[model samples]
Target: MTEQLPLERLAYWLEKRPDAVWLTQPVNGRWHDFTWRQVDEQARRMASALQALGCQPGERVALLAKNCAEWFIADLAIMLAGLVSVPLYPLQSAESIAYVLRHSQCKAIFLGKLDQPEAFAAGIPPEVIRIALPYPTLAAQHDWASLLAAHAPLQVGHRQTPDELLSILYTSGTTGQPKGVMLSPRAFAFAASRSVVEMQISERDQYFSYLPLSHAAERFLVQMSSLYSAGRVAFVESLETFASDLKHVRPTVFFSVPRLWTRFQQGVLEQLPQARLQRLLRIPLLGRLVAKQVRKGLGLDRARILISGAAAIPRGLLDWYQGIGLTLCEGYGMTENFAYGTFNRPGQVCFGSVGRPMPENQVRIATSGEILFRSPCLMLGYYLEPEKTSQTLVDGWLHTGDKGEIDAAGYLRITGRVKDIFKTSKGKYVAPAPIEGEIAKNLWVEQVCLMGSNLDQPLALIELSPVAREQAPARVADDLEQTRQQLNAQLQPHERISHFVLVREAWTVDNGCMTPTMKIRRNVLEARFVDELAKLDAAQPLHWQ
Candidate 1:
């Protein structure tokens, strides 16, 4: 089970757990369950249709869809047809999607639940075939059920070898144009198997998949891991129904990003004032009742393991969740290696660290402080970028490009990105991550970005959370200032923030503040605020307007 490709593993479940539910999708506000046999049959039929359309082995097909049951079916169908799958982030802009389509030479697309049809449609050439998924927003040339009805299940006589190319996952670009990461079946399988062992995932565990399936974290952690463990995957339809979906699924193993985790923490705080909640938790019998109710309300009482990744989660956020009995273990991984290098495992956990390398992986810290690992899970190389690939993979070690420090106990604490370490005008270096993490403790501050290019000291630009957004401007200013002064008191002289400035506009993916994977676009933010941030250093920490 630990050594097989995903398609082979799926075949096993189809035979053994044919009656058990494998994928659940939310259709028209109603939950629909699909058995393993149903999923397999659909995928096999899709494979036959794809082959009939003349999609050749090793050719790339793009998947432009949100997280749904059909997304898995289409993905498996691609592999079953001996073709490579190239997933496009549903939120990707027309230009970006167009670049990917051209770059990957993808001749076909599976469109499903597109939020913006015009933008997605801009990428496709007139000649490329559009295969509709169950809930497609894009006008398509073909339908999902039609394909299954028209074609019989395709039969491939042999199992896909480990060295066979499985998919080319494009990196979630937080900085530049996304690069296609080439991975073999063995690479993804190794990662999924390692994650299963580390997380102790099993057949009975339930998985909630809401994060974009195209992202490596969700693809490997929730999707591929479910395939390997034979866990049931429940999909969320949209943001409005996240709570309802979670309540319905009550997933055993939950994986999420920091942004969503922060939102959950905020939701808890809204229900019970932080001080009152703490006071209540200290009372023995009442504390137990409070904890149970709180967990139940948040739909996490059934969750045995909760993992957060994509970016460093604030330690304060972790403590807040743990206070209410949800332990969020941070995970570390990347597109190049399927994001399975390290994880803060249960019982042997360090709060701020992403834990040690998995049992099957080896991590080494280079003299430059870059975290390096040589794993079977590492991708073959970046697609069509030989020079960049050579630069990243040197002497058999994959340079993670992330600076890290390993504790004496072997826990790995990511410091920041190598490119994120910037020198101030004072000629002192500052890493914004630790400083931002500390300041993120402030309840009023939803997010913070630190910048100090050519400035004597760094300045913090803060975005208020929804609760704080509703506050009077004066109150918001005072609270932000207090938080700034308190954080400054705890920092090194050079690292201390000189001033805090309220960001006038909220940063969002559409506004270029966020990447598709929900990571802050640091470079983009810094560029947008360079002059403004520099001007703020001479002024008071807050501006009411």
Candidate 2:
């Protein structure tokens, strides 16, 4: 069953349940439902339109959009047209966007919703054809409505073979240029099919897709998973309507990044103070009722499995969700592996660990402590970069740059990135990830990065949460000093935090401090604060920027 391509799976649904609704999209505050037949027809029409525009087989076509019904259809259309899909994050900087487009040599691009069209507009090369989706977007040579109307449904769409290249997904890295991960149809099929089975997803399962579909995690979990399982997918229209849309869908499966999960917790705490909430949870009957109310309020009432990934989440955050009767599972994967590394199964979850490896996915730790993975869904290689590819994929094993440890129970706990570990002036090395995770448990901290490098002891740079920012400076400082002292008690003498610097600005994708997927660009942050760190006195326990 895993051997079948995604398009073949789509075709199966089209034949077996043509009338079943596959996608629910919100347009202009109105919900729009598209059945399997409608999705197939639109994809076929777009496939023909791509051919009409002189796009050739085996060529690359880009899709720049948020998660929407059109984004899914355009992906299928790219596959049907015998073109490799190259998806670009809508929030990517112009330089990064230009680099990907030039590197991928995309023949055409399909534009959809973009928050900053002006910034992205500068990135597109004039030679590349632009086809705008049926939404308000940047100017394009062709529009979706006209093309679908003009072209007939492609009857003999390209049939993809198992090993045929399906997409080139660029990783949103913390440092250097983004590298394109080459994936085949078989990779997506294997990962998605296996994932659905592992999670017990079925035709009745529903997915809420708000994350950028360009990323491998969202592409696999929401789009490809739905295709393989014949499940329904609903999309959030915009940030303003996200809550209402999610409540309306009440999806069975939900996935989110760590930053958003933190924000969600912050939102909850804003309404009900953490102390009061904890007190309520201590009650028997009232605790259960409050938990149910909290789940319903967050629009996760029906979610059978809630997944958190893309970055390390604070264990305290996971426990907080558990207190509310939601098992927020953590998974570990990368773009090269189709996001199918390890998953915390529903009943057998292990906090602080990313859970055991999925069936057939071999995982081991190298002598240097880097996690090594060999899976059926692994990427072919990095696109057009044999040197990097050779370094990453060696001896049939994908060398994950992350350092991790597997317990006796087979659950994997990511320690830190091999490159991210920094040595202090005393020559003692410290893994910042675990330390950062510990600091994140503090309610005041919205984001935190621990860096010492050549210093005697590391200093923590923290971005204060909204609630923390509103509090009196003395109160915030007192709380942070307490957290820092508590954290230092658990660390080695050389690993102790020298000081805490509260940053004035929030780290965001727009400012380039964070990747589109919400992972902090550690290198960027470290460089940005070099002068600031130089001014900090080692004796001071805390400093506000």
Candidate 3:
């Protein structure tokens, strides 16, 4: 049977596995393990403390943290105490965090390590009590040790009902203000259960938790998946130590966003030139040896499954990994659907496809060419936005704003978002994602944004890799020109890139060019290039150099 309620699933392990290792955290180059029994007792104590504070059932309790063992513990504690978990993205702006807090009306919050504590510090009001995780901040009124000691263990006799609110997940807005999506206990239960059926996630699996759990993908697929499957989880200490963390844990299952996957590829290319690496991988018997060493070097040698999602991964990058024995199955879903829509399965992997619809989940192409899906994992609704919810959740079908198509093999290929389609002066709509994906495949290109928007034709705004930047400007320009020519040859006149403008600045979350999840803010990119795009020639520029 599929494990649904997190606390119930966790309790089973506590009773059955007792001494089994459940979670591991890295601290100061040392690893700490939490047994199933230990986690149960700690979470029960935390639940007792929350209840003792007079927190009522279904009250919103915010959790502000990065990926850690305590993050999951706190999540279970909140749920066991019959409260709703409101996840706060650690990298969000102070204004956005503040807005979510006030909007959710959370009476209490648990704080953890954050990159920008000061940015969101002022958002927490005086009345809202704060409990610190392992990493205490100035905003924390009470620490983890104090809370655990202050109260006895809670005896949560009953599991949450399916209809009860499990979490209030706020969108990582790429377009406008973030809105909260109320996910019911049923939604999570269905998603986890389906994950077990579709992906064959078992108790023996090991997971490396790196991405911020605030995102639905990580929340459902990694954190909750680990809970439901009784799998062991290892948390990354920091980006500087990610390499060592991966090696130390040597996870059997891994998931990454497109940007990070690309970064990994770039890292390898930096150590061994792409041309030489490609040549080495083609040396017959030596190729197998080379591939094995490369996979081991990247700490993915033991991985039974590797997933890529959130945004479109460059096909060439995915193919390269496949060539080296690591086949990345692209998964597709949004916050509205619990990231359980389509996932390319093991052994039956479809190249460049997000794979088939999950069991019990129905997927169809709407008349507008949008991907529509209805499943048990579909969200309850947008929190306090009934009209907006009615619009999106029409007739029990979630109208995904994503543009996708169903192939003959039943795999789904996502093209782009509905709002992302831009039209040029010629009145032809250009899907920037496919174009961006093509340019991003180049080893030298770090980031690429396709822009046109009322211009005569589209232009590719490219940021070269650090190694590419280290090369002489003439060489860099020559390489870019060659890349541009190659891309334009495959595109129609309207979709062709007019020029490649080298961006001197890096796009980051702090700079408002990237979301907390590392997804590019296209509006921000377009805003930065509006003036430059206007100055470009009408025809495709032959002189990129």
Clashes per candidate, residues 3 or more apart or on different chains: 1, 0, 0
Report each candidate's C-alpha RMSD, comma-separated, in the order given.
Answer: 1.6, 1.0, 1.9
User: Candidate 1, residues 131-247: lDDT per residue as tens digits?
Assistant: 999785788889998999999998772368897778898987888899999989998888888778767889999999988888888898888999999899999888778898888
lDDT of 2 at 341: 97
Per-model TM-score, in order, reads: 0.97, 0.99, 0.96
Better of 1 and 3 by lDDT: 1
Tell me the deviation in Å of residue 497 in model 1. 1.6
Q: How many backbone clashes does candidate 2 have?
A: 0
Candidate 3: lDDT of 6? Answer: 63
Model 3 steric clash pairs: none
lDDT of each: 0.86, 0.92, 0.85
Q: What is the C-alpha lDDT profile of model 2 across 89-140, one tens digit per residue? A: 9889988989999999999999999897877888999999999998888999
Please rank every candidate by TM-score, starting with the best.
2, 1, 3
Candidate 2, position 212, lDDT? 93
Per-residue alpha-carbon lDDT of candidate 3 for residues 130-197, written as tens digits (9 for 90 to 100):
89898745467678999899888887533778777889999988868887988987788788877865
